[model samples]
Target chain A: MKKIVLSMVFMAIATLAMAQNATLPQNITIKALDGTSVQTSALQNDGKPMIISFWATWCKPCNRELNTIKEVYEEWQEETGVKLVAISIDDARSANRVKPHVDGNGWEYEVYLDQNQDFKRAMNVVNVPHTFVINGKGEIVWQHTSFVEGSEEELLEVVKKAAAETAE
Target chain B: MKTKQKHLPLLALLLATPFLGNAQGILGGHVTGNIQLDGQISHADSVIGAADVPEKLLMNARADILYTNGNFSAGLRFEAYQNPMLGFNSKYQGQGIANYFAAYNGDKLSVTMGNFYEQFGSGMILRAYEDRYLGVDNSLLGLNVTLRPIEGVTLKALAGKQRYYWEYGNGIVRGIDGEVNFNSIIKSMAESKFRLTMGAGFVSKYEPDQTISYTGNSAFRLKLPLNVGAGAIRADINYGNWSLQAEYAHKGQDPSIMNEFIYREGDALMLNATYSQKGFSANLQAKRVDNMSFKSVRTESGEMLYINYIPAITKQHTYAFLSMYPYATQTTGEMGLQADVMYKIKKETLLGGKYGTDIHLNGAIITGIDTNRIGGDGTLGYTSDWFKTGDLYYADASLEVAKKLSSKLKLTCTYGYQIFNPIVEGHEGNLHHNHILVGDLTWKIDKKNVLRFEAEWMGSDSKYDKNIDDKRCGDWIMGLVEYNFTSAWFVSVSDQYAYRDGVGNYYNISVGYNHGATRLQLGYGKQREGLLCIGGVCRQVPASNGLTFSLTTSF
Candidate 1:
């Protein structure tokens, strides 16, 4: 048990160091709302910042977070030229419900389906409502999991910081 | 000392990671993973039928590690279960590297070796996946390849054995799938509003023949097929705000225990249609499954080794009372339909008040496929017409309305009605009819503090019967309050009481803290025993009086 603990401690440090600079995984393909395959590499905002949120149709917290963000998404885009992509890990069972749910809520963010959670695994997202902010260089700058009623405010701050860093 | 020797190489590699990080110019890659630990301490509760646990504490833990460089990636998952949880399978009590895979993903060609998860269109014929909460992981261990020789076309092929607990199943499964997107390949169609994509998949399983004697006749042997196959075709079409998707699957004649060893074919069809715009949306779905239980092993049963998936067309309700009697898809033979509509009232209107009001209505009905038994065992089990319907299995309808009462407060109300047949759970009882009501109020006390309150009532016609031992029956009332503060910590308290014709009171209190990508949650509660389901798959969670905690982190 002690040796296992020692190895884990070292592994944590090594992983943290390697995690300093990370970007989205390449060559991963997911499905858009229109049933067309989309490459993750094509996710960009013309050198601007981007926000990626992992969600599911059945997750109440995820729905709340997305709904809250929908109210201010236009403003966020205008202020930072930031794009938000909502990825649904609803699997085949509820994959069909994502489009209708998103449209029902009248959300304009780009939506995709990670039916088998390949992208979710690649991104190392343990749970829904996990958000990541990417800079102009496609480098992940900030990340958070779970959301509260007012968590959107903190998310905007991170996007702004990332946008500002890209500006420099 | 021996354990240290075993991990010496791993330690050395970890010690050298810093130097490797310094060589970013050469490797230019990163490492990422997630860790989760869940522990439970439960004591016997005779009222709820919670059995005494010999092990004072049961824990399940897993760590996933991945290394990525350009188009190449590799990962492994180490899992440990000191003793399986109440709902989980005991076969998973040991610990090891449950999953590992190395892959090269390129623009046109992608290949993966070792263990991997894959799914065909709609997962009707092939779906190798995992759901930790459901304790269902059927990922295949073998080779998977995908090719995109031209734009708008994807081809995938895989061959492997299904993962059965710590060992692989005897059956070898192979499948190939292809999909084409018309809008991407044709220039004229690229800009058109009408879009179309079609996919087809074929899967086959091979297992060595096994001898089986006819019941009560030792001289007669039942001949089992050495190979069974299933195929599916799917299409997705979208025009303007209207969209439609459909998939049809068929399986060859294969005798299995789930179907009483009937030499009959199996088929399933699912169709979905939706129309939506900015403020309103409508969706309708229908599905029919007949003897479609396709498992890797002919004799294997109960939530594992399924090569095909038949999704339930029912709303996965969120409210505690509304989902008390959830529906699980019947793979042998069932038909169902669901309809959902959502509309948002304009703000400043009387019903909308200061903020817009959102209204959602959903309804679903499921029934057994009408069939006439022609013969049993070695012969065609039953015959059914496509349009005929049989006994009602489940039915539910719900309506929800959400409106903000003030800038700081929001309220939502839901009403649901359900009719469930106890036969689905292998029990014999009168149909249960329930009426449920739920009210939720969320108050944003401040920028970083929020308080939410929920109250629910369920009135059921079915009374609690000790013979059946189903805890979900009887009239029940529940209340919950949660407070989140400092944008990081939260506390929740809830209680459910069967005030009429019931035997138990379940209460729970939990506290949670989240920091960045890591979260720790602790709770003490009396849990009700029931089916914990995801999608349509379910596991029986035994009732327990316990303390539970989970910690998860990702880097």
Candidate 2:
């Protein structure tokens, strides 16, 4: 009985420390790799369509998925005019590697650093390799966790559907 | 509210546009945002629930607000954790503003003030920040400025008080850092195809420590300097198919509550090299950290108020069993090495017909650093000497292969071997043995609709430590199947079982409908027991019997 009581106390304490939110707050700053400042609003494509991939240098899946997509990114862009933005959540320890990592990988997508994870937390991303698909009007249309070998192909198909609708 | 305000600014900007609404009241600004939610209502179960804590309902939601103008920007977060789920810290049960900050940028001069987050070199000595889901917000509310006096020279200085709990912590903290980026300084170097970037940064902080009590001399109450300093220099050079990077860092005596004894300062080094070409690539990485235990508070919980962030170099798998065991960095002393290689077999070959085949192999190992302690009888040693060798701590090796098989069929197989030590993480000190095999197949039925299947098997050689574990060790198996109907609807069913020795047999079934931007998902599952991590953040998961519902909409 005494052990159960102690465990209950511990459970209460742990649950109380978790902070949850249903929607993102209204204020935050988005900075570019060169440390240049861009209005969060500037990232808007007027709801046409967009893809934001949460990644980190230390995350193997993030590296794998990003490189896999880079191989056919130009084709996706030409087909849908959709811009895929790769956001690096590499904190201070690996933040310095952001530049070289991008250059070495030869990825042509727009890159940003979220060392603080303000954006990641807002998006409720508990892990790297989380991808979000936004429609042309600026709404999160879909989100998928984790990446398999050909998940990029599935993502592109989704983009193609959105593009076909835009043409219609 | 943000979306409502967003249009007015655009409308106003469109009215101002001489050409029309395209640029006018359009108040043209780019907005990128995301939100995630996990909610559950569990039924009372003697084995999973905490008797009185109501095996009832719990939920949490976090959103990031990012607003930026021409040369300046700002962001804030609103979070709520109403009875957060099992195995999570409860202090964040209350709902309110979790984080807020702003910054301004210009040529050679950048200034930021308010509640902000920052990390020093490798976060070895100091890092302040926020993580909404796990309810962690340790931003230092103060002033910060960055000055670039020369083309390649950059300097930064900050002084602030740390945020503890709902308010600020009792301790005051201050720090200054600077770095010179060689690539930025030389325009000619930028023009060269061979990319090279070299830079160095140092950070120092002052936080009074009150726990260092001494008895030898009553008057000599070792007033902790709270003074901690670290320096790091890194270089990246790329020539042809090969690229290399190396970094070295050292920290001076700054005692935080994490490393009890004033034992000694810390030093670390990291190196990475890679080679790539058409259809093939390889990468290698190595790192070592010694005697570096720095924290903000001596008495705080083990993972809280971390002064430095230790980056782990290993692949993080997402499959249920693949992720069952993870390698968390041991900052006090550790040495690690990793290698990864990928090869693609061209089409027309036996394995690759028209699309080709992909094969990959990756391996990593970590060990403890060798050290000899020499110091005072009671107080923390002033200095300790460390050798360049140590014993193996952990290792993970894996091989994977993917084949096209046919136009309509694709298959993938993966095998992994791992060794885990319990001493560093504080659970069980026994060494762990794990072996896993995975296979996946996808059928393109038509194109608009498809079916995917995945099966995995994992076996362990280590038994649970009798001291802490109520149940013994177990072999595990997992399987997943999903069907997609059109572009907006999908359904999946997965099950994980620990039938051999442990007691984690869980089944989950979920279906989601993505109509435009609104997604609704409902799931029923028995959550297994284990540690879960997202974005370098970790939390334990308790076994539970429950139903979960999630609805997310953004415009």
Candidate 3:
């Protein structure tokens, strides 16, 4: 046990020292709302910044986060040409309900299903309500886990930054 | 002492190389991962049926580290359970490198060596995955390969042994799968109204033989198939506004502990259809299974080493009381059906004031298969009727309505009825019928603050008995209030009280903070014991009076 702890401490230090920028993974398979197999590498927002959210139907915080984003999505898109892509990590049992639930909630966002969680594993997402910010180059720039009432505003700031970088 | 000495140099090398890489940032690969640490402090409470915890403090921590450079990547997960918390498997008592893998991805081929997860069509015959919160990780420790020789075609092959606690299971599993998209392959079909895809998979397991004596007659020895194989085929068809999917799987006879060493061949079939437009959608699903409990090891039982997945077709409720009696999938012999519909009322109408109102209706039913034990020892276990259902296992029907009363306020009401049979869990009792109602309200106080409230009530025909340990068979009331401040901090309080035929009050308060990629939460509560399920897979969580803390971060 003591040796294991010592090894863990060394690994932690090694991880901290090797920190660098994050980027989007390629060739992972996910499903569209229509149940078509789509590759994650093909996802694009027409040179605009994009936000990807990992969520599930039974997760309360995930629902809350998406609902909060829906309230200001239009304005955010108009201002920065931003797009939010909501990805559900629901398995086969609940995967069928995702479409109707999205329609009922009246959320105007691109929704996809990660039924088998292949894409989630590739991106190293630990939990739901995890959000990622990708620039126009399709590189992951920022990310945050969990949601609070005002976190959307911070996300908007990151989107604006990515958009500005593209403009430059 | 030998193992410790062997690890010393590796540790020193790991600690020294990072500093060397730090000096040359351009050559250093990008590192990304996440960490989750959960700690619990509990006390014995006789009223709640919580057992006295000798350790008093328990912690579970895991850290994943991935390094990616170009098309090559490697990752490892370190897990530690300093005396696992209640509800977790006691076998996970120590710490080690639980999982590690190296993979290379190219345009046409991908290869992974070491721990990995994979699932075939509908996971009817093969699925190896992990659910951390449930303490279930059945990842395969071996080699997996995926090839895309042409557009819209994917081929996957894997061979491995499943992880069991800290060691690998005693069975070797091998599988191959292939999927093709008809529309994408042919140019003319790309623009056609019909889109079709087909897939098939075959999985086989090999285990060493074990001597088995029949329980009914101890003098008789039973024969067990050393090599068990299962095959599945699936298809998906989509047209304008409509889609359909179906999968069928069949397995050769294999004796296992779950079915009392039955030698019956297993089979499963699942069918789903959906129709959707802008504001309306409908879905129907049906499934049947006969002796379909596929595990990696023949002698293993419980939630570990499962080689296949059987999905329960039921409505997964989100409300507290509505989900009190969540159903568990009966994989051995069962038939189930489910239907769902959703419609939205447009704004500016009688029922839709300023914003639209949404209505959702769902229903599901599951039953046991009609079977007769016809064989003696050392023979096929039973014969089952193909089209007859024996007894009702579970049934549920629910309707939910959500409306936006104002720009800042939203209300949702739900009503549900459920009938559950205790026989599903090997208990002999009358069917329990329950009615549940829930009202939820959310108010956006301003741009930065929000508040939400929920009230729920459940009335049941089954009365709780002190002799019976299940606390869910009773009338109960629950209420919750959550407040959010500055979008970065939140606090919530909730309580559940058994108003009739039961005796217990579960109360909890939690506070949380989130910033960037880090989140921290703390709670103090009295938890009621129940079966916590996710997507039909369940684990028993014991009652506890405790303080809990969780911290998660990613870089």
Candidate 4:
């Protein structure tokens, strides 16, 4: 079984050498802060770049990254017309705390709950603080895992680059 | 063995090659996956009870590959635990394709084959999930189907055997669930301020009969039910800024080893209420679990094969001292309540300063349910009153305040108090009372440079006893400093010392580097023995003086 599985993976790698842009998966449903269902396909910024971050209430690094981004979010929005979407993968144990944590931190990003981590698995995110940059066409253009103090600066650079690409 | 180890990295690289370009391929369907490798090398430490390891090194690695088209998706996970790491089950030493599934998720209908994880109504009566850190994965291997015949209405059905290590359990589990959204289903309520959703689920497990002597009496045999069933009902209501969720579950009588072969039935209840606005929020939760340890095989009595899950109501603290004594939910019989409040003082005020102040307070208390023992085996083992209280199990309260000292610096302070009884972990001791304090500071030195410092102190009333070897006793002090540079590299160093009535001093240092979608970290440290828990499920971790490294990448 192990040999077969390994060969299949290698076959896939051989055929997928050429790269093409991939759109976000549709038909996946998540919950807004108000307990309303939201479709993944509806996550749009009106042809502007969007930043989606996967975080949790218990992850300290994730909180740090979000708080840092919140500091310069307004200025970034003004400059690039970008939107930041925060998804909480808190599950049943701490899902209830996401809203309070976000509000208490004064974060203005659009927040949603992935109680079952369905969206996290769909994005193939292995860990928290994973950030993705999407172009105007809803294609994922850039992505990063983990965060340090100045990673937000790099994130903004990608957003600006994506916005520039879409403008042309 | 060396040759096998060398092939692992090559295999992972081959699996990761397709997504290295950050694009989809293979007939227009996206090929995405993640790879994680964790390794440890440790030496024996008698003072901390770290056992000697004959193997010089141990590693745990896994790779997940997923292929997705418009409405169809397929995925598989390969896991390899070469000689399994400490704190992990030795049964997992071998590795293979642990999980695989194919599914079609469309607008109206969905079907999945092979392994799948699911939860029904807050997972009171049914929750099949995986927590890699806790070494708990109960995903079912079977067929699952979902139907949305109308808007706001969902129906689901599933049948399969639970996964046990690399194999499947003997029992078969079948379940059905339905949910309705009133606002969406009823046109008249579409614009109503009140939003409501109700759901119900029924699950049953069938295990073949086995002959067993009653209470070691060879002449007597006990009758066992071939099928045990459990049902749950839940409601989620939201009105403006107020929200409430409640679920209740009941199980039929089925003598099992977890309950000491008792025929008594089981039940659980959970409630949560919350109100929130822009800058403030409050929440309260309450739960009660009684004889609710439902598993696939009655004879199995470990952390595996649980057919249901009961979440703990206590807050999951992030600070070291604040979470020193983590709470693990008692599925047999326990009651608990938790309250939380968060408020932000306005900026430029007397106490708010220029950037405002954030205040958070949380408290929780748990107690055992009152019960009167009747008899063992072949009889109702115990009787309990619904509204009566028993011994106190655990209680804790904490308050944290944070403020931005400047545009480039931030400060946070916290105070916490806790009382813990060792019986919850199958140990006996007087309740330990502790007081903890923490202070944290962060400075953004520049656009690409940052530094953080943390200090914590814990004072406890419990004394260290050589008989029990509980290292968590006595007073402790910890200090840490971390620096990040170049937006990609970070170095952290920390030490924890038991200043009074303790035996060990643990120190650690680590360096990490990150690139796009990839991270690598290497560290050498002395680890303290304790229970590593996530969401009330816990696994015992032994102390070790070790070198550890991890690599993670996703695309």
Candidate 5:
């Protein structure tokens, strides 16, 4: 019991001291919505900032977050060269529903399926609605987990920050 | 014990390296991790059938840390289940570094040593994974290697022993898989309209021989096979809007407790087809399994040590009442089919508003295989007809409609019908029929405030029997209301009441706060006993009245 408490304290301190310098993961392969194999490292936005959102069809918060973002996606993109990439960790059983769900909602984001969750594991994603912002240099600048009613606005703020850094 | 002690310094160093690297402003390397802690305190309640808890407070906590530098990466997970929470196996007590792995990814080759999770060909033959909520962690401890020999060709080989709680299983597992994408392999096919991919895998397990006594003739003993093997082949083809995938797996005859020690060969077949357009989409899936309960240990039973995954072809419901009775995959001998369709009523149509309406329909059915029993021990046990389906095991049909009543409010209504046979759980009884209805409304009051309400009702013909003690058999009603404010805080209250032929009321209230990558939630509730399922894996959760707290953070 003492050792567990000590370890928790140590981890808390270490986490606080850590830096936010995450880079895009490489060499992991996932499937595109069209059923074609695509490498995570190969995803590029033509020197633009990007937002990656991890979601699943069964996750209500994920759907809520994405739908909220869809309402202001165009404005965010127009203001900054920011692109959103939605990744589905649906596995095989529910993987078939992703494309239709996205299309039916008129969401204009690139979608991919991580059936085996290789990319999710690599990114250290513990739960859905986890979002990451990548700058033009491919460095992960910001990330958040879970979503509230207006969390998309905060995401846009981070995207704008990444875009500003790229412009500088 | 001495060797383990000797590694204490190494463990300490691994834990401290990330902080030191960050302090030194290290370049080109990143450290990431997540932590989750769940704690519960409960008291015995006779009315709810909750058993007295010897441990008044139970907790489950885990921390996963990963360090990555270029193509080299490593990770470790520390898990502590201090008198594990209810519903989790009690075997998971104590704390340690449950999983650790180091890997190197090269241009065309990657190798991982230590603990790893993997799957092959839709997981019909092999799948090693972890679901913390389900208390399932089947990661293998050994080595895994993946090689991309040429463009579009990938091969993987692994040798390991499955993790059983804190110890490794008694059997050794080895597997190899290879896949080829014709479109990428052949230059001409790259631009073709059709895309094709094919794969094959072979998995084998080796365990020490064990003596088994026949059921009727207890004096006679039989020695089980030391080695069991399974092979699978799969293919995926796509042409424009149409796509199809299929997999077939066969396993050599082996005696196991799950199948009553039958020597029948195991086989499984799964097929899926899908078509989609801008406004319409449809999916169809069919699967059949015959004596395919492959496991690492012949005598081991339960949710762990599964060597293959039987795909569940039913719609996973999101509504409360719709999910009251979930179907468990019958791995022994079952045939199932599922179909799903989604269509959008375009804007300006009669049924469609300015924002359009979405409609979804799904149906699934599973039946036992037509089989004739033979002698049980030292025999094939049964003969099954490939084209015939026997008794109906389960069926579900559901329809849902979603519309934006206005810019601030969205409404979703669902109707579901289910027929379930108790035989799915190895119990024989009449089929239980249930009809459920749900209405959910979400209103966005403002940018930072949202309110949601949900109500569900389920009418069932099967009454709850005290002898059987299945709480899910009775008619029930549920209601929930949630309010979110300030974009970071939320509260919800819900209740479920069984009003007819059953006596139970479960009420719950929860509050949560989220900031950045951290979330904390607290709840006090009475939980009704039921089967909690994810994918096709089911776990029995006992009734309990408790106060629970959960905290999760990632960096």
Candidate 6:
């Protein structure tokens, strides 16, 4: 048991050390379906906490989690002032339908398009419904893959706690 | 909505970022952009819709740029399609900023004016979008609003016209959808071992479809904005290692070009269950749909015209032959089932060998739902309810085994059996028996170099032509060799020989280099026509002989 613990700590330290020196991931530039463009880096919710979610039209889990946030996102923002940028990773094949899919869902989100997967790959995303929360320092504070119905709310709670600590 | 406003203004007040400070203001506007390009050259004699599409050169490209600072942002996309690749909207042969919009984000409220994507309750009633590869873009031109008055509740409202090709959809669409998180509302559900979550939404669209019919007649003559509505509710709960989820949706009737005003009402049901432990896991999924084909313009083909998507619950495969005949979800009349299980032997055990042994099993079946016609020919007909089992469309069962021979060597093998009925997915009548086998061996000679070899064999029981055809049953064998230098550079060579049946033998050679933050790859191959999919959404890529290049980087 002692050896196992020592080896795990060593591995963790080594991996974290290797990952630490790595350059900070650059933010992505995406087009709003409406013809507007936004650089993910330029937006500064960093002082608080920011949630970046990757989603697409054909992905049900993506929609499910987004919809859940749609229900409580406003309240969470008001209380914790947390921000979320819902990034749509729909390729050219489904890009045109993006407008209607968003309109129909009636979701009030800061939506952007990663049409070419530049943003998707930049963040090492291999699956839809991937999410990242950054601190005010522009560092990835937390990240999760896949989503269940209630995961969004759980995510908000974590952000709220992080924001509270920042305030302290 | 709230994310953009609070941080931007706060950042300006705090003067936290030095880069944003410039001439007119301390917070400078941002510059952002993206581009997509697809080009194809082909040759075929005649084309029957898309089934026998002739070969031709085609290319599509689009780029977008946006500048923003403070609480404001705006951008545009430039598009170009010379011949419009296969399955693209025929009208989009031209090019330009097919979509654009502007917006403001705030704490309790937000507003946007321009073109965008929207959906309500699985997007059955209202959906606008684009899929460049499959040649479908249906952006909406309009205004949208998001409102949040309390915790655990959200509401969205929007009105717009669809973007067709370089234009807009021929209809006026407006919708409102809201969802509630039970845990957020109840509070008590928090901190419990058993977690439960639930939500519901409603969506609707209005389109003033052109007053015309198939036989040169005026249908609807209604000359009114076609109205379609839908509602959906979903539930998800998890306890320990087990989780289950389900969603139900329904959409009202609205006629457009695709179904020829075939009053095919829409509805869908999807369910999934999963269980997992230390080294074992199992999952099951089932989905059913009927007459739920909802689109702004019914006449549109390919993936662009879909009002909603039915996710295929089956496990996506990686082996070449096993993935050749991928099953695309049928939104009209289809029922499907899938099951998957995986297990790994504990290390240090006799059966685990030196490292461990891994086993995986997967099975999937898709079939059309039975239905009865309600009207005569050339008339708007109705179909029975969905969920009714009908003729089987396709089925595949597969198993995989992997073992570590020693500390530096490992091998994996897989086999699959498939039953494919073409008629169900709009193909001509014919059932097939497909058998596939795959083997892979990996060897690590030292820390700086590694080598791998792969082999595959596929056989079809009855691919021969019964008529006056000299073509015989087809069989294919493939071999691939890969060499890796350190962790940055790699080269691979592979060839697939269609020894007996098919018209063409394919060869592929690829070289790639990954430098942690960036990767570059180049390849030349004679690609066989097959279904290409990511996630649950899928589309078919045509047979092609060509060279390709790709580059990816992150700063």
Q: Largest lDDT belongs to which candidate?
A: 1
Name the better of 2 and 6 by lDDT: 2
**Candidate 3 on B1-555: residue-level lDDT in tens?**
001143344444443443454445434456677898988899987667766789999888898876665555667788888878777788888887788777777767889888898989889999998988778898999999999888889899999999997778999999999999888899999888798999999999999887788875667777788999999999988888788889999999878887778788999999998887777888899999998999989878878999998988898776778878879898889999999998888889888778888888999999999999977546688998889998999999999988888877889899999999999987888899999999988887887888888999999998887676677878999998888776567788889999998778989887888777777877788876554221111223445689978787887
Please tell me which model should have the higher lDDT, number 1 or number 4.
1
**What is the C-alpha local distance difference test score of each model?**
0.85, 0.63, 0.81, 0.82, 0.81, 0.60
lDDT of 3 at A26: 72
Q: Residue by residue across B1-555, what tens digits does model 4's lDDT show? A: 212232443444544543553345445677788898888898887776667778979888889887776677777788898977777888788877788777777888878787888888788888898877566889999998988888788888999999888778899999999988888899999999899989999999999998767997889877999999999999889898788989999999978988888899999999989888877999999989999999999899888899898888898877666776889899889999999999999989999999898898999999999999999898899999998978999999999998898988899999999999999988999999999999988888988888888999999999899998888899999988888885578788888899998777888887888787788877788866453221111223445579977788887
Per-residue CA lDDT of model 5 for A1-168, tens digit only, reads: 445654674566445535557788788778877566677888778878999999987776787788778778889989998999999988666776787677656678999988778788888787677889999999888887777666677788888888888888
In CAPRI terms, where does candidate 4 land?
A: acceptable
TM per candidate comes to 0.94, 0.77, 0.93, 0.93, 0.93, 0.69
Model 1's CAPRI class? acceptable
Off by over 4 Å in 5: A1-17, A104-106, B1-26, B216-218, B528-543
Tens-place lDDT digits, model 2, residues B341-370: 777777788766676777878898998877
- Going through the candidates in the order shown, the clash numbers are 0, 63, 2, 0, 0, 64
Q: Among all windows of ten consecutive residues in candidate 2 chain A, which has the lowest summed lDDT?
A: A17-26
lDDT of 3 at B223: 75
Which pairs of residues have clashing backbones in candidate 4?
A: none
Q: In candidate 2, what are the lDDT values of residues A19-43, reduced to their tens digit? A: 2212222233344555433334456
Ranking of candidates on TM-score, top first: 1, 4, 5, 3, 2, 6
Best model per DockQ: 1
Number of the candidate with higher DockQ, 1 or 6: 1
